[model samples]
Target: MPKVKRKTKAKSKGGIFSRFRDYISQYMTAAAAGVTVVAIGLAALFWAGGYFGLLGEQVSRMTNAGAVAMGMDVRRVTAKGLDNTQRNDILDAVGPVIGSSIFHFDPHAARARVENLGWVRVAAVSRLWPNSVHVSIRERRPAAVWQMSGTLHLIDENGVVIAEEISDAEYTNLPLIVGAGAPATANEILRALRKEPALWGAATALVRVGDRRWNMRLQKGGDVKFPETDISNAVRDLARLHDAYGILDRELEYVDLRDPENLIYREAGADETIAG
Candidate 1:
């Protein structure tokens, strides 16, 4: 009789309530997984039946309507960096976004449409809080006027056509490039001519010959035939010749600088070629 020390048993920690909670948790977890699978199957069925797009569109419309009801509709659109690009063009590119819900407006599509314009080099479109949309853009800088097929087009530094059918009086200071491939190759010769201010000032237009070489139409009334290669050196030599012997000042029919070592010219009324 040791006072009956082992007579009583210890109670279980957490008792029956803990076990009940665990059982309920497992049951609910399995039910939730079953529901998720059913939802996934329904979604796949909708996709296979070609109703997914329509369902998504309906959901989007509902969401947009709800947002508009909450005063999230676009009321004003602001634009920046719109020098050469017309305001109307920007508005058209963004579509009828003003009366629509700001949350439903697609900025990427608007940007793409804006960038499709000839003058817009790059564009950005975005929503501004609850009731505004914003647009930003950078425009191409015109480098020259290209003349082809009896039409005039404005071109940028990279020879990308900015605008077509331009008037003759517009941008009179920009150099005119002639022939089919002239715009693509005008930068090299134009840059070389720029180094020789006198030559650049005398130049009326640059003509691409056979898409290989260039011939400069001079303001003084003659043409200068340039070699296909070593254009910079040839231009420098012509500038030197002009400075030394007044070669460009004379009344000449044409100047041929195709040969690096020879300078040939023909007088306005002479048939013979003169070498200097």
Candidate 2:
């Protein structure tokens, strides 16, 4: 039986071509994974080195050059409603515009920057097609001269400070507001005084008392103590008294209108007396 043992070929796992194909498939997969890792590492390196930003800038420059060649670049800038806002300031806020692509200009951002200026109440920025950019702004109106800590500032009607260190002569027509928290309450008294042209014209300064009420200093060396409530009526009554008896025209020290039922005043040298 040992002598009769027959030789037989071992069962084949696969054909030679199949084995070669498997080797190539494994090799390709490893190579692909290595390539992916290398690509990610290079991307991180480029980002860390700011190369991505430079590349983006270069691409932008090229795009801008192409746009310029197409005659879509900004060549001029025009602004309206400038008033107190400097033209150079607007140009600076709008960023680089000449020879830049008009389509790349951000109008909303430019408008926001322009509106941040002290005098600009509102602003609009637009790209004029083909070659121009336009900016329009409305300036804040100077309502009063707010004096704080010996420095003068221009304020708008809404009590917003417009500009600081302003010259007194330049804004002499504006009513002067003195003391702390005067700017916040100036509008109401200013409106009330405006109703009486004589009083408004004679007012030199409006001083805030305890952040609650106002004491009006007159140009003729007199003061009017205003009530915390009923400011409009108090101003009207004072104006009426002035019209009838020329009380404000007199050489008076102060007029106390704090009491709604009684009007009291004092001459420069006399004691205080109740008005009839």
Candidate 3:
């Protein structure tokens, strides 16, 4: 007699996680996605409430209205350097105190307008209570008059060109630095001279040469050459010679310090010669 065939149960291949793991993982992932959505919604709600209005235009209107209610009479507006016409321009950019709230005023724009004065390197602005506006300024200290591209312009220590129209009378004492990136180059030359009081007083112009060489021109038009290698030694050696012989007191063309073995110079009224 034929008996009824019985079905056998299949064995799991990937441990206990083979069957229900997929559904469980899918549910957990869906839950994590839901949490992220909620977090984003809350952040957006806060940003909108702060910058915009929590309840439509009501909050915005209140904030702006509070500032408007404190408008000033503008009895006095004071700014420095009115002679350069920058004061008026800056004041115009800042607007008047009357019927205006300092909260809405743009100090950054006012600063920019003041900087257009050419001499003003930086500017500070403040609101002086209800009736007046106060402003302070910092002018750029000219480091040198740079000769670039066949034209000369006044420059600050940071290589920023200050003005093209600075009269010599206003900055006659400024150094004359020539060649590319002379402002940065001058810093090193000036630093070296600062170590010796004699050179500090007599060093005038710094002339760049050969892209890697520097020449220090004294107040009397005597040039001191520094080779790219061991340049400091050259300067020290020259300074020592100058201290010993008082070479600067005589007529000379230049002092070639680049050669350590021998020092050469051109007599002020005579030909070039080697000095021990």
Candidate 4:
């Protein structure tokens, strides 16, 4: 009988990956050491370049390039809560980082620029991850027009100056205040006047006198003088008198409420006095 021919087994040729795994396992520690040495050398080179200031120009370019490649650049800028602040001004404040990296942007610096604008009262700048910048601004509201030293300035309720050299035609309807310290004390007088809608509506302006007291100008052509102390009580009394007797509706030149206990009124172009 002929013996059966035995089939020879084919020699196995491991793939490239299998060979690579074997190589890495055998020299794993040595490979790690080599990588560490290369990293140290690169770090040293960067430090030397920075110490000599040779890396400043290249560093920014490289950072920007890398950031762009990594999709970390600013792709959009948005402004919120803008009323009188022009859109161009807000864009100018954020112009520096329009296409730059959000990582390199300074939010504080941007916020300061926005707040320096004429209408911005409070501003906040922020970076959205990967590619967006957001700026929120609170614009100053014109509460009154303050006249001092022959100039008019727009002021907010908190006594802060919003704009100077404002035109009367633009803000003709707002309450007008005159005097050196009028802006600072304007809110108090305005608040007191709000208690009496009829009186407040009939009035036009409030002038600070000697930085101590106030003089209110009526729409119908008269002046109302208020005392330095107990102003609220004085205002209450005036409101009561006006409501009960229609005192303000009369043709009066001036009403002196400086003395809360006494109601003094003088007619227009009249020497006689009317008291209540």
Give lDDT: candidate 3, residue 2.
95
Q: After superposition, how far is residue 116 of candidate 3 from its true place, in Å?
A: 5.9
Q: Which residue pairs collide in model 3, if any?
A: 251-268, 252-268
Go through the candidates in order and give the clash count of each: 0, 0, 2, 0
Ranking by TM-score: 1, 2, 4, 3
Q: In model 1, which range of ten residues has the least summed lDDT?
A: 1-10
Number of the top-ranking candidate, with lDDT as the measure? 1
- lDDT by residue (1-276, candidate 4, tens digit) is 999999998766777779899888879988889999999998898787685366676788899889988999998889999878888899898777867877888889889988988789999999989899999998988888898888888988988888879887768878899999888887877888877788878788898999999998987889999999878888889999988988888777999988767889897989898787
TM-score for predicted model 4 compared with the true structure? 0.75
Provide the lowest-lDDT 10-residue window in model 3: 81-90
Q: Report the lDDT tens digits of candidate 3 across residue range 34-107.
A: 99999899989888768445565675556556766665434556777444445566666566655555555556
Candidate RMSDs in order? 5.3, 4.7, 10.4, 11.5
Error of 3 at 207 (Å): 1.9
| Cα lDDT, model 2, residue 116 | 85
Comparison by TM-score, 2 against 3, better one: 2
| 146-239: candidate 1 lDDT, tens digit per residue | 9998899999988999998999999999999999888888888888888899987888899989999999998878899999999999999999
1 or 4, greater by TM-score:
1
Candidate 2's residue-wise lDDT over 1-276, tens digit each? Answer: 367778999877788889899999999999999999999999999999999999999999889889999999999999999878889999998988898898789899999998888899998899888889999889999999999999999999999999979887778888899999998888888998988989877778999999999999987787999999889999999999989988888877889999999999988888657574
lDDT of 4 at 152: 87
Runs in model 3 with CA error above 4 Å?
Answer: 1-70, 73-75, 80-99, 112-117, 194-197, 200-204, 218-222, 229-233, 260-262, 266-275
Task: Estimate the TM-score of every prediction.
Answer: 0.81, 0.80, 0.59, 0.75
Reference-based lDDT, residue 220, model 4? 82
How far does residue 276 in candidate 4 sit from its true spot (Å)? 2.4
Tell me the lDDT of model 2 at 248: 81
Top candidate (TM-score): 1
